[model samples]
Target: MIDTSMGLKDMSKRDILVNVAVLIGFIILCMGGGGIMGAITRNDFGDRSEWYKALIKPSFNPPNFLFGIVWPILYLLMAIAAFAVWTKTGLTKEPIPLVIFFIQLALNFIWTLIFGKAKDLLASLVEIIILWLFILLTIKKFWKVNRGAALCLAPYLAWVTLAVALNYKYWELNPNMKPDYSWFVLKTEL
Candidate 1:
């Protein structure tokens, strides 16, 4: 007597909505983290070409323009990967995997602050190694849940490895360089 076909249609629609919501949340979390950190640093990633160019850098350091192109794509991939895993883990129900995911994300933001904002090359180099480890751990945990999700983090891991090398190079090249917060601050003299 009941309308079984209608019930199935409603269920499919609900499932689709849930998937879309998860994807959107992941994007917001991933991109928003970068956005907030970049804002806190006054858009150093995009606006500091002159300052970065003046610094002594290694031969392998990519042109300043390359970063602006790469980061958004990486962030999007990362978000999709996390969402893939989260869906398998049942959102808030899976605690450990989610914890590892968040830990890595937090470390990611901290690395940006240390390297780009604080300009603490030596400290950032150390922190980046730790960040890389956490990322590896996150990927491992994600693999047990979803292989695709794990693969998504592979590029991120590779990029962080390069970042560690770059950080070390910056530290090695500029031994006596000091953190210059003045560059980011606005001065008002009467």
Candidate 2:
């Protein structure tokens, strides 16, 4: 009986580890997807020095550096929420909610490509609205599986709402500011 109990405990521990590993992998995938999409869409690559600084931002805008800090934590939370749903219902069973989560994530990456790389502020704003809608749907579906998972998405949704407003404000302030590809060239001699 003691040996059986030990086996059960070990199995449970293994299950926990597997769940944690899956969650971390999902988060990393989301981050990597966004990074690659951003890199591919941007012509100038690492040269945000010119475009970002030249834009007229609202006084309420948070420092650009703050975005770097906030998104990783939010993405981790999003992954945890997704993992919680996956573990609760198994991956194949929760198709609708899982699809919603993926749709929102795709939109999240697309928004960066649209606004940051393409410099289409209006299109980005529209895309963010779609993202917000999908996020709401994901939250609702997650709530059905696990309330904690639903709650985990709250910060991400809030941040995106703030981002939408910021995008609009930037568009309003810099109506004519289109991204120029020439600004991306480095000064190094060939």
| Highest TM-score against the true fold, candidate | 1
Which candidate comes out best when scored by lDDT? 1
lDDT at residue 122 of model 1 (Cα atoms): 87
lDDT of 2 by residue, 126-164 (tens): 889899989999999999988999999999999988988
Q: Against the hidden true structure, what lDDT does model 2 obtain?
A: 0.77
Q: What is the lDDT of residue 139 in candidate 2?
A: 98
lDDT by residue for model 1 over 84-135, one digit each (tens)?
A: 7777776556667768888888998998877777778888899999999999
TM-score of 2: 0.80
Instruction: Give candidate 1's total backbone clashes.
Output: 0
lDDT of model 2, residue 118: 68
Candidate 1 ranges with C-alpha deviation above 4 Å? 1-11, 42-51, 180-190
Q: After superposition, how far is residue 123 of candidate 2 from its true place, in Å?
A: 0.7
